[model samples]
Target: MTSKKSPVGGHIPVAGGMATKGLKYAAEIGAEAVQVFVSNPRGWAQAAGKPAEDAAMRESGVPTFVHAPYLVNFGSPTPETLERSVASVRHSLQRGAAIGALGVVVHTGSAVTQPFDDAMRQVREHVLPLLDELPNDAPDILLEPMAGQGAMLCATVDQLGPFFEHLENHPKLGVCLDTCHAFCAGHDLAAPDGVQKTLDLLVETVGPGRLKLVHANDSKDPCGSFKDRHENIGAGQIGEKPFAELFRHPEVAGVPFIIETPGRSADPHRKDVETLKRLRDNA
Candidate 1:
């Protein structure tokens, strides 16, 4: 793929029940990229996609990313949940390919009641087979590290190495860094050099090449609070200054920074996108 500076965008709802509408909404808000759910985020059911809509999205020239269902938990203790999680990922990748998505983001899920070792074993046993099944042209499966809530698998940036090791460092595996989650998990993005330190840590741990997508949201809670609530850019605990640092980080250049903040309407998201673009341009 031809690379430029980093792309700034947001997660917009499918306007009027059409994926094309969502793409249009993203453009209306001056987004350079976009993220969308191919199916119900909270459900296991994968929706059938239309080729026309996929073609339209591809024709729109906006870089796209697909977020896998929230129900996916590859580390689940139950066999059925594990099976469904694998299936969901496969389905999401298939849809992502159809829409020419750069990556498909899935949460690095919790181990729940199981021991962390057992969860890693489950991830190896179940997730490896699914990875093996992917086509050569399939989009990268971007593992998003979660806030340090409950028994989350990749609770911090440093913990991602183990997850990649469990998968044998597959090329199809990558990372999606969420600013709010990173702060909530104790990376402290509000500090002057915090965004740089976090990006440097990520580059140190995963390498700059493996860093694929970014969820650029401010945190509603304090640093190390472990809450996952996402506030709009510049309006929460993360403030606005650090995002300039994020924009200036050399490692983050060409990565897609997607905002998953509050407000369902286009107006709020438009402002957020503008804010990020301004930061990026002036950085």
Candidate 2:
């Protein structure tokens, strides 16, 4: 059964209601796991979850994830931005807990015109408290590495080393690797042995069990392009083959693969989910 296996799903839109819109869309796409944004993805607004919607999500019995607002930049050089980022993350963790989420995915934001060392210093100061403050059963703060664009804090698997070190490798901190990001960061997941090599490095860098989620998407740009555009599975630069390798990789055995591929229509997401399921089952 898919429940006992690594589930494949997509980032379901939660605009109307978590259950009525988000969960309903998930079912239509045959998603075994789901990810949703609890607030405006591109805004700093911190919105609370509706009790009924939260309860409905909990009762759905599907693995769930919460994506923190896209504008959350913990490494921002500005004081106001940093303060709001910290508050936003705390809010996301609370919302994730309310909905029985497996993790809260936050972008490993940029240094943004600051020295890398100084930026990481800010990250430690702002992020450590939140990690330390999680309840025992609270969802992990999963760091989704960026596409190596601009001044990303953690893009390549190796770069995660310093990020984890600064946070002292807190137990509550986990990783959410995005294929497009890794490819853009030059992991070469499209190569014959690229997926395996990248997974190997990730396991080595973070140690086992820290990779909690995977964003399964193809890239619109070629490897090392530093672009974040996502394409449908097998329909772009990172071909279908690497995903098969990913499915068989021991490091990701039980991790959920959530697609952030292009298209809001259920049809595209369903096809992507079904394609991943085939690769997963065959592997």
Candidate 3:
């Protein structure tokens, strides 16, 4: 059982269908942390959180985090879409606070026809005010970079530097580094020294303090493939060795690693969680 203890409390299921059962399922498996979506991931509708369930989860002593809806694209070409995205982000931030979540994760979407500088400007203009309005206890807004595919932005860790600069060190702004996405963005984390180099670059570019969470999904594609396929922990293109390095990295010792891997019917929660735990313990 001691060997089963997860480093950052392991991976969590972000499905809303398992919302009520999420805490109980997580507690039974000895998870020290968890992440959930406040509503349907494929839609924009925000679901009302249950106080009783939230309290139960809090009492379980498991740290919780909320993931924003998947439909939110801050870089939408349409003004209406951008407006809705802003509203949805603000709502998720507020909802995350209500449920005692540490933070809410949102994808760093593309700017479409707009220049990257304009995208950064829009984020600063529309998102910074929301962060400023958050109370001290409000959950932080974590930006997750996507694979370097299409117009989708935030492909690299260094690319996010100017965007963070525009926010001017907002307390509520942080990062959620996804392993698969990082690999897809051209940062090699598979070789013996790969994970260390990538981690060093991350700490240098984003500051370790701003790294609030991680999505520990192994990719189904090769390095710099620009694909978003996520396989089970060790059964992917990125083998399991690099994760040992990731788990032992002091900068990310206590950050939550949410499983954004595929699968709904036959959820691989236990396997993935145990895989991370084993890596941490072995290290």
Candidate 4:
């Protein structure tokens, strides 16, 4: 979030190079803020990035975010999984700062085989230190609540309270609210005034300035479906009106909207970015 209106963008690809290929894609889609994975989304690898990539992104002057691998689950009951999760998170934080990411997004994972309390204890033990040791220049760690599926530790914005408590509300800790996940978690964003209510609750839950980013996506399933499928804006169950309302929300005044919508090339991402820009400008 900043002093100006939110910038809309997409999760651009970093195939040949981050700044070269990724920013090219970002330019193609007219992104104002961007999101990218530092490693394989479904794997445990955490690769180092090039300094040129970091310098290029920083010089580009666009707000950016890093989405951690999907396998990061500190709430896991298994020893190896928890270890890898912590390492992966640490690497992400390092790489994010290197690449000038404004925030690093990691999912609020599940309890798996353990009890909820035990899993949260594990989270506190493994994650609190990382938050505590974050460099002054490093990006904030954004905890992304998942869809209300399985033993997810945090889904609804209300659930974020416990996480904040465990981490003692670290200043660098933030939240990335995914539209499709919220819809599936039963926020009812498709209903009239639903977007307002959800955002109001988010501010209430996390307090002001903690909502750093928004994953601007639509859901393929109905509200309360608990599915994570993402669709294009206005082309799914959440519809487009809610996004217009999102633009009008006072709490997310300077936040960036990054579309994680369906797309193979830049066409769909460009459309989603333009659509959000229209809604935001019109709002």
- Give the TM-scores of the predictions, in the order they appear: 0.96, 0.98, 0.91, 0.98
Q: Residues 1-283, candidate 4, lDDT per residue (tens digit)?
A: 2236999998988878999999999999999999998898899877778889889988889999999999999999899999999999899898888888899999999998789999899989999999999977899999999999999999999999999999899999999999999999999998997988898898898798899999999999999999999999999999999998888888878899999999888899899999999989888
lDDT of 3 by residue, 190-246 (tens): 987888787787778878678888888999999999999988888898888888888
lDDT of 1 by residue, 87-206 (tens): 888998888888888899999999999999999999888877877777778889899999999999997899998888899988788999999999999998888789878989888888
Q: What clash pairs does model 4 have?
A: 1-254
lDDT of 4 at 200: 89
True-vs-predicted CA distance for residue 5, candidate 2, Å: 2.4
> Cα deviation of 202 in candidate 1 (Å)?
1.0
- Candidate 2 per-residue C-alpha lDDT over 137-232 given as tens digits, one digit per residue, 9 for 90 to 100: 999999989999898888898889988999999999999999999998899998999988998999899899899999999999999999999999
Show model 2 residue runs off by greater than 4 Å: 1-4
Residue 271 alpha-carbon offset, candidate 2, angstroms: 0.4
Quote the positional error of residue 198 for candidate 2 in Å.
0.4
TM-score winner, 1 or 2: 2
RMSD of each predicted structure: 2.0, 1.6, 2.9, 1.4
Candidate 4, lDDT over the whole model: 0.92
Q: Give the TM-score of candidate 1.
A: 0.96
TM-score-best of 1 and 3: 1
Pull out the clashing pairs in model 1: none
Backbone clashes, each candidate: 0, 0, 0, 1
